[model samples]
Target: MSTALPQSTGVIAEYRARLAAGSIVFDSAQASAAERLQALWAKLRGYDPHPKAPPNGWVGRLLRRKQVDDVSDHPNGLYLVGDVGRGKSMLMDLFFEAADVPRKKRIHFHEFMQDAHRRFHAIKRDNPGINDPIPALADLIAEDAALLCFDEFQVHDIVDAMILGRLFEALFARLVVVVATSNTLPDDLYKGKPGRDAFLPFIGFLKQNLDVLVLDAARDYRRERLHGLNAWYVPADTRADAAMDHVFTTLAAGAPAQPGSLMVSGRKLAVPLSVPGAARFDFAALCGTALGPGDYLALATHYQTLLIDGIPRLSPDNFDEARRFVTLIDALYEHRVKLYASAAALPDDLYKSGEGAAIFERTASRLEEMQSDAYLQLPHLT
Candidate 1:
């Protein structure tokens, strides 16, 4: 209802506005979590993230200003955890949008890690003798933002898991406040994985640095939304395209889709439409390119849900593209990434006969299963 931003704006107020307008139904769990975020929002008001410098002379050096102001003593942040569609990210986004911070960023955790590794390597390459780049990376990030918010916070790569503890510890020490939304709790992170013992300390450190709130809302709102639409659309018509657009908008919530990059080995693969834990792509962009299993795997790993547009009928004439589509489906199926697409034909009818016919059977079967309720209910495997 308000057209302008105000200094006193808070997440609770925004949530109530949306609730009143019927944009969202009020769940007690979401309301309680909003209160916690509101508390943090209040603490963050008028809180300066920049460190003050002492006089820049011998006296300053003598004083050594060992401390960089009181940034390190800033308030602890909040960590929101819940099942998918429980509104953990929604609430976090509300707080991030309304917070009155001069320097702040809200990013998906996957892309953050990808950039982290890239920067970490660059730092090491630039400074050959620098053994640890985590502190430097943290400092670099802190200079840009005193507040960082992450969506779909998750860790599966051993490399990322190893570096996270140090990276985040340094970030906290620099007075950077972090807010994250995840489907898992702090302790369950990297659980059952090898080298998990070393990761245990990081989990404990995270718990200490942030207040964790669980939002086990009674309904699966995201699933409920999906239930109203057919997961796959046939004939690739204008109506199908409109429906695809709606699906993408609904799943992305209020986050804007942006052109993003995925690090595959050492190469950067371009993602045309990246929306937090979801991505949208035209069939040509995905299957017509010279991409391999590695590229598709990277896509599957990054986006839990994919909205694809204009998947043409597969046949002998476009055998290469058809094969690539099969590879893409295989990767998505393996990762349990939910798919929504506009296609020229149903999965079975799309690949009726050709050189790819034999192997296409598996892909067709997987596509059908992917559209089923049982498959949609399964959690994506990282």
Candidate 2:
């Protein structure tokens, strides 16, 4: 499906209009990338839909023409890499919305893999003796979506790592275009996995098929918008609770909050409330249980901002919870994940007397720093 370009205007012009209207902040690097993506979108508009054909004769020739049209006319897909909160996801959202392709889909990478695994199971169940499933699965996906946009592209599961090279090779062979955003570059993907050497060929394939662009703007645009906003609320009350809810709604762009879960070390960590880029939890749900740094790190990696509710003051009676809170704070701080919380008291007064009171001083200091403009502007760890 083709959409008429708004008169002669392009995506760059639309973006500039947003800047002029104060709807978005202007960033030169991001604007340049958007211009390039607009060019790619125009090239994609040239190709017709994939043709249907029998094995041989005139129909077969039409199939060959389809391949040539795509491979020769379409530019390489994009691999957009940048620091967290640098507007990579936001820019890609704009590109996806503006592209007027009927056979296109944009999804989070984790959700995509989950769907792929489900497809694998269904294919195996239906065709018990199939020698190879990846090609068939790729064909099915290409039939549905000629263009695939993936957000937060990451690989942690060995099962996923092993299958991606073959699966993506099949997709590309069938002329499926893929655009992805990630905090890590193509070369650094799956770094330090137990058998990382086996994943190298996929990296090579990605480099050959996608034009890697870095959006290395110095400012963290999300943080800039959040400058001077209150992050910590003491004496948790109805007003503080309402403020937390407002912040979550604002950052999530009005997406409805729902329960979210994270799979860490084969266990599900429950989240009480979540939208696309942020999550909220109760203190008991997080620190009251036996969670460690690994769990916290997983949360930090997935959510750009976290909101914790009902943090009671720390004392000797709740020493274990205090320790857990310390670990959680450390993990969040190290990853530069933004924190919003309602507590019984301020950070310095939270743990007046506890087993780890001395060490808690540093935690207190970090908590204060996390609320500052300078610390909020730091890029998140990928």
Candidate 3:
């Protein structure tokens, strides 16, 4: 089997070509930031074509040689913070793809922390006497990835906030360069949280270890795309399905949808199709099942946009499903998640004859409001 060749031009050049070709809107600030990141990538790639192994045992040295080059002339990593839809994630993606490195991994920050928690548990299980497993965990990660790119870096969980300082300290010590994108600045991370003072050191550590840059673009690209477009498409049909598919693909930026699961209060909620920043689901997979407010809230928090297909007319026969749908809408509404759905009827016509028909009126109102420009302009709850 033959392998595919990487692109010859740098990331900034490629981005400029896209702008020239009208594939993407031109934003001067975003382009400038991409140029800066491209410089960093060039420095990183130029450091060592052939790395020498550490003075460990033969097996250890061999493993190290296979993973990363020498830790010489490594540049400080990047912390790109920007407003929602300001092209931060898009720039990071380009940087990750263009970087020439033997070992690099790009992942969402929430997923990274989940994996970190699982690894911590496993390491703790094996090394029972160790008081801290973070160093060993960081070593394992460094063995596989010298460059770590994280998207949508938001700190919401206290468990993560408490451990990040020590964990990142160890990773930096091992020369694991990280590039991350977030909506909040380093100083604003975990703001207004209880015991947030304990999380401050991690913020300082991040500031010292990474070159924080802001993508100061004024336009929200996502909202611009949504302008005058119908967020809710009724009479779910072949045309509506195709339109929904196009919208999801556009929002996902060519990333293929993957199957994922969300753990909500000891229950596993299956997501049929998902890419970073968006998810697509069948109405039955969500409302026909026994999902609750917590499950929908978790989904709203995770994805900026949710595309639901095959929303059917509700009746007394499927009262429970209708009730669940109402709760799901409420959760999505509260979180300001952009909702796109192909439905059997208009929101008002969905639940015409149900015991909760009066309550369904509120859900219908919220659904209509969610499609409005005001709701589309609201920032997503992370």
Candidate 4:
């Protein structure tokens, strides 16, 4: 009988060290994010599926060459849902960053929707000959990676509600495994909006393709840390220079909120300047304008933090305006933006009118997201 040669312990130790340090760049060409993800899948597939079991210990399985699932067939498509600050996003980030996949793309859900909307319009205007953009989009995704991850998956805007089908169809067509974390269940997204019933098909598609898992521990991780007065809302104490100084100092430490109007596809936003440490944005005028998802998307890309005041009422015109406001805040939050807001009342109490209760629900959810410990940890002043 042929005997296997003894493995060198020194070499094995070196290999482990290299892997831990991320110095073992698996053949860049071969061990792509997609491939790395497949490696993880291979490792996972070999493990016992039972609730209680030890790690995989089969030598034969280890010796055999494993097949990584194509983008479409990867077995671990995931849907993680829970209340804010319950570590949903942190878990997603860990999975996306550590899991080996041949090609991997982790997109903030809001940003992705904004991007999809932007591309759809661009394609429509530029290539009118193409009846549908889904096919081309699918091909592009297929070429890039076999895995995709999204953080804070949500659907609120008319634009998002309209394109859910085409976007998912393209992504799913490529056979890419999707991992998404959301505050809302897939079925409950955009629940109360007008014509929301139309989105059922997309929800059905998600349910069929993804394994939904809920991490519903009631404890709000965000609120636990914010229990005391230390984190409560506090406006800048000093007037004029102190306020502006605090704003500038706070903003400069994080992403610089450059004083410039943002433009998206010919739309212009006139940004007001702060004297030294204060913001110049006219909240009334900004909210009063024709606000929509597009406007928020533009602001999100440019500013990581926003402070808005003077919200008298949260009516439909106000709700629609605030919807964009919420979308912008969501987008910024997805990008890890710091937000500080002051209104006549708290978000939950902002709009308590007839038939407009839905806006309050959305507002409460957004406020929770903003107050999450992860968000709070970002540089901010009260």
Best prediction by TM-score:
1
What's the alpha carbon RMSD for model 2? 5.3
Ranking by lDDT: 1, 3, 2, 4
For model 3, residues 1-382, the per-residue Cα lDDT tens digits are: 0132322366777787778877688788997897788778776773332243344579766755544354344568999988788888888988898787788899878768877898999999999998989967877777778789998888988999988888997777677789999988999988999879999989988988899999998699877765566778878999999889888877866567899888765578889999878889999989988778888888987888999999999988888889899889988988789999999999989888758889899999999898887788776766
* Model 1 lDDT on a 0 to 1 scale: 0.84
Indicate the TM-score of model 2: 0.73
Q: What's the lDDT for all of these models?
A: 0.84, 0.81, 0.82, 0.56
* Candidate 4 lDDT trough over 10 residues, lowest sum: 45-54
Candidate 1: count the clashes.
Answer: 0
The number of the candidate with the highest lDDT is: 1
lDDT of 3: 0.82
For model 2, residues 1-382, the per-residue Cα lDDT tens digits are: 3455642355566667678887777788988888877876776664335633224578756775567556655457899999767878887877787665778889878768877888987898899998888967877888888789988898877989998998887777677788899888999999999778999999998888889999887677676666656899878999889888777777775357899798776688888889877889999989999888888988887787899999999887998898899999999998788899999999999988747789899999999998987777665553
CA RMSD, predictions in order = 3.9, 5.3, 4.8, 13.7
Candidate 2, after superposition: displacement of residue 355 in Å?
12
Model 3 clashing residue pairs (backbone) = none
Query: Which has the better lDDT: candidate 2, or candidate 3?
Result: 3
Candidate 1 minimal-lDDT segment of 10 residues: 62-71
